[model samples]
Target: MKVGLVWFGDDLRSADQNILWRAMQEVDFLVCLYCMEPHHQRPSRYATQGMSENRRRFLQQGLNGLNATLAKVGQTLFVSSMDADTSLNLILNEVPISHLYRNHHGGWDEQQTLKRIENQYPDVRIQIDHGLSLFTPSQLPFNLTGLPESFSKFRRLVENVDSTTPLPSLHKLPPAPSFNIHNIMPWQHQITDNHSAFTGGEEAAMDQLSDYFSTNLPNQYKAMRNELDGWENSTKLSPWLAQGSLSARQIKASLDVYERDHGASESTYWIYFELLWREYFHWYATRYGKQLFLPGGLTGKQTQGSYYAERFRKWSQGNTPYPIVNACMKQLNETGFMSNRGRQIVASCLIYELGIDWRYGAAYFEEQLIDYNVGSNWGNWQYIAGVGADPRGGRHFNLEKQTAQYDPNQNFTHKWQGQVYDSQLDSVDAADWPIYPTSSN
Candidate 1:
């Protein structure tokens, strides 16, 4: 029996899919899989261990939604309790898999995993499609190594380059192996409904796109995107985008519709512009590889600050002196979501005001955010700390100034209980007796 394996990672959706399409054309039977790695359930070296509860719940929803889609085409998602490497070994051992297929992921570790699979199973035909980003590697103006050093430079080169149209939705797929099909639990679309504040699947993502564009919300995105809090102010699609349940082109496709229905405006253009920013980081992470997580980042120039536990805890829990930062932190803790503006305010506070290592802030975000993407999360922290792509050294927002501007009425702060506390920024003074903060990853 010729069997192909579709290993689902960050890319969970079935619509506009490339890997599944090609797999369907060749394989007599296919098995879909998603592996929940051990470390993802444990804590990391920073404030967070693994994925946050909110993040896990959202991921589960994404899986359910994807499984529902696959079920429609006579397939099911086999979620294993092991990590990717272990799961692949076990599956390939049980069945002589003819091929392996997946979408390209930017994380260095994710790429390495696939590379190892290719080397270990040379006979297994490996196919990876670059469907996650708006543009594929061949579509880029320059080679991956020659990617622009800054977002502005990258923007200037690609802004005129149009995004490709998303492939049409899939109506059929290869059947799962008869022996493997019965054991898996099935999910129907009815099992998932819009009950919580946000839903995780591709179905929910498409609905959000349709509903947002059906009204005048896209027209106001640019002006309201900076607000401290408001649903209509922004697209609120990051969580879905981060999970890969909603492809960037899927969102751009909606923008195309909205533009056709109602003429394009600056707000509409800004929507695509933000997508370009995301596309830039996807390439950035791929280009920098291990350096994407380094203290000096891509530049090899180290900056100030190390890990101070007490200070890190206070900053993450929303107990710092800055009310705006406190409010943002608290909002993140309560919900897996945060405004983009809030992320900037809290990240600045962690690096500049509190004197904590920027990686701690990045790691904490990786733990808590429902929308966390390895490239966007780490790349962004590096950007704010002046260790990444920012043309300016880094951003140091005046908390007082930011507070007056975004929370003039203090409504957001009050709702999140962002009360000020008087205390020194440093947990330990330069006593010859006190130990230095540990800065290792």
Candidate 2:
């Protein structure tokens, strides 16, 4: 019987997955695999690990759901902490694999890994499906090399182009090949807090999407998206979207339904607009390759800021003098989530006010954000640091002005600042305190 393997990377869900669906159709028997790379646990240049506790927890939840879904269809997801190359080597040795399928991620490292795998195993038939974006590269008006430099230009070209309809969720799978694979690694699970707003899994993603659309949230999204805090302010679909538990095309399909039922408005259109921004970055990363991660971004312009360890530590800990920046950072540190407005505010403060390297800030966000996307995270940092496709050199947000506009009454600031300040005080001694005013004070 023909044997095939499906390697789950960022694409974790069974729904609307072309790679999974195609693999099921083409093979008599299939083995589903996931490799938990060690790189995720190691510290990055920014002095932060790739996956934070919150992100790890969320990922584990998603994996559980994926595995359960597969089991219902008489298949089991084989997970390993071994590197992709080594894990695939072991699997290929055990089974006479006829074909391998995986989603095409645009990161330079991902591309390099695929190349290395193909070189190592020339006999195995490998098929790559571009499942990450709302529109495939072939569907785009321009090729990767010819992608527009700015988002507006890119949006104009593809705005009218139809997004591919999401494939229905797979309910059946080919029988798993008989194999005694005992070396699977344990999933690192964390106990999530009861009050946590986000949960991982395709079910959770759909539920959030359903709940958000059930109300007038999408109607007011454009006006209230910039609010620093509140669940109702924005569609919280990003974390799932980042992990591929939610597909961009799936969201677009729902948006079309909402517009047909309720009249289309700027708010509804803005949702598609943001998704286009994500699509732009995905292609941009593909075009630029490793340059997206370099100090000099796509433009090859060197960042003016230098790395300061102390400043970076303070920034990560949300101890900056700017209360607005602190609030945003603290929110990220605690929840592994932050509003888009909060991200921009804190990112600008790190690059412009703190004079720290933009790459470090980008790397830190990759470590902290549960919703982290390599293209969006690095591309945005490059934009803010004046190294990417921004028409303006860079964004420099005035902290006072931002605080006044977003938190006029200091409601958000006071909420986060008190927690951070109290935590800082707990580590200090009386000698460090200024009970009596010193001349310096």
Candidate 3:
């Protein structure tokens, strides 16, 4: 029997998954696959692990959710540890596959794997689709080659495009599918002893989305989105979005429905606007690939310095002596999440105040964040570090000024001060946190 194998990458969700849906249509029997790539969890030249325990746990939850959903439809996601090329070769040999389908992952490793699959199995029909962003290249105002450098320019050109761009429909799985359960190989690398906060699966992601919009949370998002005090202010849908457990289009569609049935407000519109911002970054990364991850960034003067493991450790551990920045940094270290405001403050402190390398900061985020999207994380870091697309770069957040503006009452500072580090900045006589250099991604 001709069978289809659906490859899962960072895109872990079953819903709105073009590859899964396409596989269902092409083969009478099908299977889904995910490989825990070793490189993803290992440290790069930056001397930090690629992912943290909190992120791993969150992904596990999402994966579990995806597996449960698939089981209900009489199919299963077979997860293994072999690299994509080796795993695909083994699966193709065992499953009698006629086609291989997957979503387009823009990472360098993923691109290389796709090439290997095509060259190795020239006979197999491999279908790839774009479902990660709200605006795919075809639907954009210009080809990626001609895409604008500034986000404002890009947003202005593509903001009003029709939502219905013929997205692939989610398909029902067959009652039973040909299997290779026993043939699964052991993971090539050592699984980390640490666990992550978010689980990797579809059901958990759907649960998160349901909770975010099913209540008054969406209504309160705009008001509290900038608050670093808690998680209630924002939808916190990024981790799901990053892993493809949820699509930007799906979230946008739901927002439209929510606004129509409920009343449209600034909060609702703002969330959609941010999603578009995220969509902009995705396209931005695609339009300029390796440059986004570079030290000089897409737009900066490249500077290299010693990787002072000590200062970086203090910063990452949230003991950097700056109250607001430390509090946000502590939150990220503990929970694998920080508010957007928090991200800006801490990242600014790292690149500008600490005079640390921007690459170290970027890699640190890549290692810790559950919602670590190469495009968004690196793009924002580069922008903040004065390297990326920002016309004017390097945001050196004044701790006193920021605390006065965002935590005027000092409640936020007081609450988190002793928890992570001494309330060093709380002292009136302390020098305003030092600003070291001009920088961005």
What lDDT does each candidate get?
A: 0.86, 0.85, 0.75
lDDT score for residue 94 of model 2 = 84
Better of 2 and 3 by lDDT: 2
Candidate 1: tens digits of C-alpha lDDT, residues 107-126: 99888888888889999999
Query: Which parts of model 2 are misplaced by more than 4 Å?
Result: 185-193, 418-441
After aligning candidate 2 to the native by TM-score, how far in Å is the CA of 58 from where it should be?
A: 0.4
TM-score of 3: 0.87
lDDT of 3 at 382: 83
Q: Look at candidate 3 and tell me the lDDT of residue 12.
A: 71
In terms of lDDT, the poorest run of 10 residues in model 2 is 418-427
lDDT of 2 by residue, 352-402 (tens): 987988999999999989999989989999988889989898899998899
TM-scores for all candidates? Answer: 0.93, 0.93, 0.87
Query: Candidate 3 residues 217-247, lDDT tens each?
Result: 7777888888887668788788888988888
